[model samples]
Target: MRALRALRPVQEPPARVTRITVHRPSPPLDGLVELIWAADSYVAQAERERVLPSGAQSLVVHLGNGPLRVFTDEDAIDATEVSGAIVCGARVTPLLIDTALGPTVGVEFKPGGARPFFDLPADAITGRVVSLDALWGASAHSLRERLMETSSPRDRVRLLEDNLLRRLARSFELDAALRLSLDAFEGRDLTSVGEVNRRTGLSPKRLLALFRDEVGLSPKAFWRVRRFRSALRALDHGTLRGAAVAAEHGYFDQAHFVREFRSLAGSTPREYLAARVVGTDHVSVRR
Candidate 1:
């Protein structure tokens, strides 16, 4: 038998490091959390990271580095840097973030995941970013202090999960309601809001209320993100023909898809695909 050759683990470069890490939450969080994750990058120059909407809200801690500048579709003039920890509201428009600030670690809550924990309605913060302290009060400030004491990324993540787990709301059917609302969205099985209400056995007003309080974006808006995400995926995979992609995804026509795509993505499908960074959700920026 030939001597086995030893294989060395491939190491990612240390300097100018860019990375994304996702951690699995224990037990009960599995249902509500899509994944608890962090996005980190270190480089001399600023990176324009285009964060697309997927109908999820992010609970972010800047990790003592950033004040990431954020711009929206409206102003394109004024930019805001979120301080300490921030909660990003669910949005339909693409968010332009300047990542020159520093590394960030945060949790991207699954749609409807935020409602159970916060007494405030999810819609209250839609299309906005508010400090964690505003929602979690003293605990948010304390968590920041604890996280700063640890240099290890792993420790920071654990600290975040621990704090949130301690604050998990008492078990209830809130999860069930959220699940039913989302189920109608799975695979575009339900066509419209009325269809979701009918399938979920929730009336129009009740479903609307639940979505406003639990999911931030209403069922209609949430589905738009879902649909947009799907189209982006297809386009990224070299769909080539925008028309075919639209038709397959249930868009009324090529024009319809283009309009909707630009509405959420801030660019035509073709333009976006042209600028995308391969294998990642983010688009490429000129250095």
Candidate 2:
């Protein structure tokens, strides 16, 4: 048998211009964190891009000149400046972000897996880019300061892992029902959310409430996100996109898939593919 690989590089910044490295946590953390990534580079001009939803939560620490700016939508006009670090809540909408002026480190937490690390309910932050200081308080600033002192990307990544380990809530535990539902859904059930609900042994209302608290998305929304991820992966891999691909990913048909794509991604499938930055979910948009 072939040896198993740990972290797979999802995106490689344009060669020579910028470099980004992604690492997967080992063991316990692996169950929650999908990956830890760091990027260091400087662009003479401001770069803006739209980051598509991945059905996950993110915590990013910026260690550079200017603060991170998140735009309201695809227009890229209205914006909010978020200094230092931010917790990007699990969302179904696209996030428009301004170019980074300095080095940055971030963590991508698996769906419903961020509970232990956060103090509040996951749904509270949904669709919002919250300042990390709001949650971690002064410690968030101190963490960014420490990251800024480190020139080595490897060192920064290690620091992030250590901080997460220190902050991990040992007392927090996932509801047994939610855990079971996640297992079934992630196992590629490719069926209906109703089936997943039944498997959880909870009423539809009860299970939905649990999901909102833990996963930040309703069961149907979460399933749609998951299905979208699969379709995107297939399309990115050069698999021809059409009704066949849609059915393979559990969409009712090509039209059904297209509607969901527009809703979550803010663009049609073809347009997204044309603008997609290779190895990343980022789409370059005109200002």
- Best of the candidates, lDDT: 2
Model 2 TM-score? 0.90
Tell me each candidate's TM-score: 0.85, 0.90
Per-residue lDDT tens digits of candidate 1, residues 1-287? 00011111112345334455557777677667665655444442235656677797878787655576777643365788777888888889877776575556677677888776677889999988888889889988788788777666666667778777777854433557668778778675456778887777888888888887888888889888888877777776675467898888878999999999888877787777766544344553434
Off by over 4 Å in 2: 1-16, 42-46, 169-173, 187-189
Residue 35 error for model 2, in Å?
A: 0.7
Model 2: lDDT of residue 3: 7
Best by TM-score: 2
Q: Among all windows of ten consecutive residues in candidate 1, which has the lowest summed lDDT?
A: 1-10
Question: Model 2, range 1-287, lDDT digits (tens) per residue?
Answer: 00012243233344324456677888678878888877766342236777788777888888977889898876657689989999998889888888655788888888887888888889999899999999988989899999999898778989999888888745344567877887777655458878886777788898889889988988888888878888888888877677877788877788998999999888888888877666556776755
lDDT of 2 at 49: 70
Report the Cα lDDT for residue 51, model 2: 79
